[model samples]
Target: MTDKQRTDRGTREYRMGELAERAGITVRTLRFYRERGLIPPPRREGRIAWYDDHHLARLRTIAALLERGHTLSGIADLASAFDSGRDVGEVLGLGEPSEETPVRLTPEALSDYFEGETTAENLSAALDLGYLATDGDELVHISRRLLDVSSALVKEGVPLSAVLAAGREVRGHAEALASLFVELLRPHAAEGDLQRLRPLAKSVVDAELSLALDRRLRGS
Candidate 1:
C-alpha cells in the first residue's frame, strides 16, 4: 500500500485510475475537468496523485448537474461560487442560533431541495443572505425553519430567485427590528436578561406580522 492510498487520519484515498473508475469516468475525462478547473487539484505525494471522498463527491455532483442539462461552463461557475462562499463558522460568528436548528446538506441534496433552481446566481445570493454556509464539502443552512419555508415556497410555484430577493428584503427589516428591540431593552435589561427575553421579542414580531398579513389579505 502506497502512502497515497491512505492519509494520516485514515481517510480513503485513490489514485487517478481508481478514482476515475469509482466516478464512472475515464481518466482522460477527469483530467479534462481538472484542466478546466471544474474540480480542485488532487493531493500529490511526489509522483503519485491522491483523490479523496471530497473529490469523488464533486465528480458525482458534476455528473448530476450534467444530467440536469447544465453546461460545463455553468457547472464551472457554480463550482467557483460554491468554493468561494462563506463557511459555517463565519456565518454564525460568535453565537449560534439559540432556537433555530441548523441543517447540513450535501450539494446534491440541496439541488433536490430547490429542484431546477439551484443556479450559480441563486447559490451566491443565498450565501450573501447568510442562509447557507459551507462546512467542508457539505452545506449548512443556518436554520432548518428557513430551509423548509424556502423549499415550500418553491414548491408553491415561487421562483427561487424571487424567494431569495424577498429574503434579502426581509433580512433588512429583521435586522432593524432586532436593533429596535435591543435599544428598547438596553437601558433597563442586562445582557443576560436580553438573551433570555429574546423569545418575547420573537413573539411580538410574530403576532404583529400575522396581523399585518391579515390586514393585507383583507385589503386585497
Candidate 2:
C-alpha cells in the first residue's frame, strides 16, 4: 500500500515450467501453443526459456475464455482488439464495459482446421456468421443451437466453410430484405410500434426463412 512496499515487491521471472504451473496449463501445452504460433516464443537464457507475468496473464486469459467455450480463432479477434488498445465495448458484444485482456489464436492454424474438403470452409463460414470464435487455438460455436445445426450439416457432408461463405454472401441480401420490410411496416406504425410488433417481427423472420427453404426445394 506504500512506496516502500511497492519497492519491496519486485518482478519475478519464471522458467517455462513454473510459469505453466502458475497459469494452470502444462509446460508441453505451452510449448504446443508456441509451435502453433498462438503464443510468442519465450525469452531464452542460454537455451532455457523464461516467461514473465505477462505470459502467465495471457495463459490465464486463454484458459478462462476456453472454459467459456470461445474458440481460439474467436479469441484471437478479441485479442487483436486489445492489442490495438480497444476497450471491452469494442471487443465484447455486451452490456457493460471492462478492461481488455489478451485473447488470441493463430490464423494459419484456423485456416488449416477448416481447410481441405472436410469442413474447414464451413467452419470458417461459421466463424464469419458469428457461429465460431477463437478461444486460444480452438474454435467455438457462440450459439449451441447453431452448433447443432452445423453438426447436422457436417453429417450431410456439407462443408462448414460453404455455409459460412453462403452466410456472408447472404448477409447483404438479408439486410436488404429487412430494410424492405421495415419500410413496408413503417407506414402502419405508431410512436412505439416496434414494441408492439416485436413478436410479429419474429414471425416474419420465421416465415422468410421457411420461404427460402421452400424456394430451394422447389427449384431443386
Candidate 3:
C-alpha cells in the first residue's frame, strides 16, 4: 500500500513530507508551524510520525485565515479558542433546539460570515454564550436565525463586539421571559401543554419587541 493509504485508527495517515505536499507547504514550513503549536502533534509509530486529515484541514484553515489578513499570532490565538471551545453535544445537552436550525461552518466559512470581525475574543464569547460549538474541524452554531441576524448586523456596520455584547444582554432578558412564561403556564398546563404552547409565547415576544423598536425609533 502507498504511504498515503496507511491507516491510523481507521483514518488515513500521511508522512510529514506527504502532509506538507498535500497542504501546499514545504516540510520546513510545516515544521515551523508545528513548533509554534499551530497544528497538533502527529501520531508516532516507531521512528515515523503520521499526520492525519485533521492536520491537513487545520493547515488549510491557517492558509485561509492568512489570506484574510490574519497574522500568525492572531491565528494561533483563534486556533486556541477553536480547539478549546465546547462540542456540539455538550452545547445541546439533553434536547436539541426544537425550532432553531443549527449551522455547521468551516473556519473559512465563518470568517466569510463575519469578514474581519472573526477575532479570538468574539469566538470565545460566542462559545461562552453557547452560540457556537465545535464538531471536529467545523463549528456548529446553535441557531441559524441568530447567526443570520448577527451577520446582518455586522454588515450594517455594527461592530461584532457590540453585537455580542447586545446578545449577552438579550440572553438575560430572553431567559427571564422564558421562565416567566413557564411559571405562568405550568400550573394550568397539561403534561405537554407547555411545549405545545411555546409558539404563543414566541409570538407575543416578537410582537412586543417590534412595537418596542417602533417606540424607540419614534422617540429618537
**95-175 in candidate 3: lDDT tens per residue?**
789999999999889999999999999999999999999999999999999999999999999999899999999999999
Q: Which rank order by lDDT, best down to worst?
A: 3, 1, 2
Q: Each model's TM-score?
A: 0.92, 0.50, 0.95
lDDT of 1 by residue, 1-220 (tens): 6534667888889998888999999999999999998889988778878899889899999998888777899889889888999989999998789888999998778888998899999999999899999988888999999999999999999999999999999999999999999999999999889999888999999999999999999999
lDDT of each: 0.91, 0.56, 0.93
Evaluated against the true structure, the overall lDDT of model 3 is 0.93
Locate the minimum summed-lDDT window of 10 residues in model 3: 1-10
For model 1, where is the 10-residue window of minimal lDDT? 1-10
Q: Residue 12 deviation, candidate 2, in Å? A: 11
| Candidate 1 lDDT score relative to the true structure | 0.91
Q: How many backbone clashes does candidate 3 have?
A: 0
Q: Write the per-residue lDDT of candidate 2 for residues 161-213, one digit (tens) a residue.
A: 66566656766776887677677778888747855765676688889789999
Q: Is candidate 2 or candidate 3 better by lDDT?
A: 3
Poorest 10 consecutive residues by lDDT, candidate 2: 1-10
Stronger candidate by TM-score (2 vs 3)? 3
- Sequence-dependent TM-score of model 1: 0.92
